[model samples]
Target chain A: MESLLSPVILFFALGALAAFARSDLAVPEPLSKALSLYLMCAIGLKGGVLVADNGFTTELFLAAAGGLALSCLIPFGAFVALRRIGKLDATNAAAVAAHYGSVSVVTFIAGNQILSDAGMAPAGYMIAVLALMETPAIIVGLFLARRNAALTFQPRQDLLRETLLNGSVVLLTGSFAIGLVVGKAGFVPIAPVFETGFTGLLCLFMLDMGLLAARRLLHARRLTLHLVLLAIVFPVINGTIGCALGAVLRLDTGTTTALGILAASASYIAVPAAMRLALPKADAGLYLAMSLAITFPFNITLGIPLYSMLAKLMV
Target chain B: MVISVPHRKIEILVDAPLLRRLRQLASEAGVSGYTLQPTLGGDGDQGRWLDDQVTGGAGSKVVFTTIIDAAGAADLLSVLEPLLDEYGLMVTSSAVEVISARS
Candidate 1:
C-alpha cells in the first residue's frame, strides 16, 4: 500500500492522468533518454559499492544462472500460450514471447525501491544478473520464429550484434563494472549526485513513462480479448516460477521479491528494438501494445505488490 | 566538376530493423550511393516515437536516401513497393535532374 502511494508512483499516476485527459504535458525526447542513463548509472553504482563491501559470493553465481535460465525459458512458455490461447501466428507469437522473457529495468528499479524501503535490501550483484538477462531471450525468440520458415533468418547476425552492443547493455554493464572497481571510496564523492538525487530523478522518469504508457494504451491496436488476458496471466505464472526459484536458492524475502518482479516484468525497450531487427514481418502495433500498454502498467501497479506477496509466502 | 543526368531520388524513412536490407536492396538496385541518417523522431499510424524514448527495440528510425539513374529506379521501385507494403515503411521516389555530381 505504501509503495503504491509513494510520490514516485503517484507522480506516475499523475502523468497517466494528464495523458488520459489529453493534456499537452510531455517530456522532451532527449531529456527522457538522459533520465534513463541517469537511473542506470546510479543503480549500477550503488550495486557496485555494495558488492565491494560484501565481496563476491557463491550466491551471486547462482542468482545469475537462475536469471539467465528464466530469461531463456520464459519465452518458450509464452510462445506456447500466444500460439494456443492468443491464436497468434509464428512471427507475432515469438515477438510477444521475447518481451515476456526479457526483464524490464525500470520495473526492477521500482521493485528494488519498494523492497529497500521495507528494510530488506537485495544483494548488489543482482545488477549483473539484470544485464545478463537482456539478450538470450531475444536469440531464443528469433530461433523459435524462424525454425520452420522458408526465409533463412538472414538478419540473425545483425540482431546478434545489435543485442550484444545495445546501448542499454553497454551503459548498464559499464557502469556496474566501474562501480565494482571504484568501490565505496569512489562513490562517496559522487554520492550527492547519484544517491541523493536518485528519487527525484526516478519520479520524473516514471512520470514520463506513465504518460507514454497511458498514451500507448489509448492508442492500443491489434490487441484482442484473449491476448489481453494472456498478457496478464503470463506474468503471474512466470513470476511465480521465479519467486519459487529465488526462495529455493535461499535469497532473502526482499531479494526474492525483486527477482519475482523481474521475472514478471516484460521488456518494452530492448526487446522491441531487437524484434524490429529479427522479425521485420512482425507487427509492432501488436507486440508493443501487448507489452507496453498491457503488461508494463499491470506490473508497475499491481504486479510488483503481488510478486512481493508471493515472495513473502515463499519465505 | 558538374554534369547533368536524369536520376531518381529515392527517400526511405524506415524502421531501424530494415536498415540493413534497405542498404542491400539499394546496392542490388544499382544506386551510385546512399546517405543514411539516424532519425531522432517521427510520427506515423503506429504512433509517435523518439530515439531517446526507451521503448527499447530496433524500432529506432532511420532515413536512407539515394540517387540513381532513371534506368535502375524502375527495378528498385518494383522491389521496394512489396517491401514497403510488407514492412510498413514510408518511402518515396521522385525523378530529378542532377545539377552536379561533384563541385
Candidate 2:
C-alpha cells in the first residue's frame, strides 16, 4: 500500500489528472529530450559505478546475454500471438510485435527510480541489458512485415537509417560507452547536470507523456477491444516470464525486478516511428494508442510495484 | 519577373515509406525535387494526435509537392491516389501561383 503512495506514483497520478483536466501544461521538446539523455547517462553511469564496486562475474554476462536473447525471441512470439489472438493482419501484427519486443527507456528509468526510492539496488550491468534490448525487436518486426505476399512497398534507406540510429538508442548506447571509458572519474563533472536534475526532469517528461496519453484516449474508440485486452494482458504475462528468467539466472531482487520492468514495458517512441515507416498500412492510432495509452500508464502506476514484489519472491 | 503558370499543389500527409515512394514518382514525372518537412501535429479520421499525451505524438508528418505542369501533377496524383485510398492519408490539392520559377 505504501508503495502505491510513493513519490513516483504520486507524480504520475498528478500528471495524469492534469492532463485529463485538459490543462495546456507542457514540457518543452528539447528539455524533454535532454531529460531523456540525462536519465540514460545517469542509469548507465550508475551501472558502471556498480560494476566498479562489485567487480565482474560470469553471472553478469549471462544476465545481459539473456536480456538480448529474450528481446530477439519475444517479437516472434508476439507476432504469432498478435496474428492468432488479436486477428491483426501481417503488417499490423508485425508493428505491434515490434513494440512488445523493444524495451521502453522511460519505463526502465521509472523502474530504477522506484527501486532506488525503495532502497533496493540492482546489478549495474542491467543498464547494458536495457540498451541491448532495443534493437532485436526491430529486426523481428521488419522480418515479419517483409514476408507478406502482397508487400509492394519497400522502406527507403533514410527510414532504415533513422530506425537503427534513432535518438534513444544512440544516446543510451553512447552514454553507456562513455560511462565505461570515464567510469567514476567522468561521472563527477556531469553529475550535477544529469544526476541531480534527473527526477525533476523525469516529472516534467511524465507530464508530457500524461497529456499525450489523454489526447490519445480521446481517439480510443478507433481501437478494437481485442487490442485493448492484449495491451493489458501481454505485459503482465511477459513480466511474469521475465521474473522466472531472473530467478533461474539467480539475479538479485532489485535486478530481477528491473528485468521484469524491462520485459513489461513497450516502446512508444522508437518502435512507433519505425512501424510508421516499415508498416505504413498499419494504423498508427491503434498501435500508438495501445502502447502509449494502455501499457505505459499501467507500467508506471501499477506494474512496477507488482513486478518488484514478484521479484522479491523469486530472488 | 518570370511568368508563373496555373498549377495544382498537392499536399499529402503520408508515412515515411509512402513519402519515399511519392518522391520517386515525382522524379519520374519530371519534377526535379520536392520539399519534405517533418510535421508537428494534426488530426484525422483514425484519430487526433497520439495517446502518449498529445506531445509524444507531436511529430506526425505531411509531404508537400509543387508541381507546375498538369502532366507532371497528374502523374504524381495517379500513383498516390490509390495508395491513399487504402491507407491513413489526407490528400488535398490547390491551384496556386509559383511567383518565382528557377527552372
List native contact recovery per candidate, as a fraction of 1.
0.57, 0.25
Q: Which CAPRI tier for candidate 2? A: acceptable
* Pairs that clash in candidate 2: A211-B53, A211-B54, A212-B51, A212-B52, A212-B53, A212-B54, A213-B51, A213-B52, A213-B53, A216-B51
Runs in model 1 deviating more than 4 A are B1-5, B20-52, B56-58, B71-88, B99-103
Candidate 1 per-residue lDDT, tens place, A1-315, comes to: 877998778888898999899998989888988999999898988988888888989888888999999999999999988999999998889989998999888988877877787786888888888999988898888878988344433555667767888778888889898899999999999999999999899999999988978887776656789999998998899889889999999988888887788789888878888888767777777887788778888888888889889989997
- Candidate 1 differs from the real structure by a C-alpha RMSD in angstroms, to one decimal, of 2.9
Error of 1 at A238 (Å): 1.3
Alpha-carbon deviation at A270 in model 1, angstroms: 1.5
**Which ten-residue region of model 2 chain A has the weakest summed lDDT?**
A149-158
Candidate 1, residues B13-97: lDDT per residue as tens digits?
Answer: 8877667777777777776688988776656676665454677454577788888877788878876765665666787889898
Tens-digit lDDT string for candidate 2 (B1-103): 4776687787777665345556776677677756766665667665665312222322356566565567777787777665675555677788887777556
Question: TM-scores of the models, in the given order?
Answer: 0.90, 0.87
Q: Could you give candidate 1's fraction of true interface contacts? A: 0.57
| Model no. 2, DockQ | 0.31
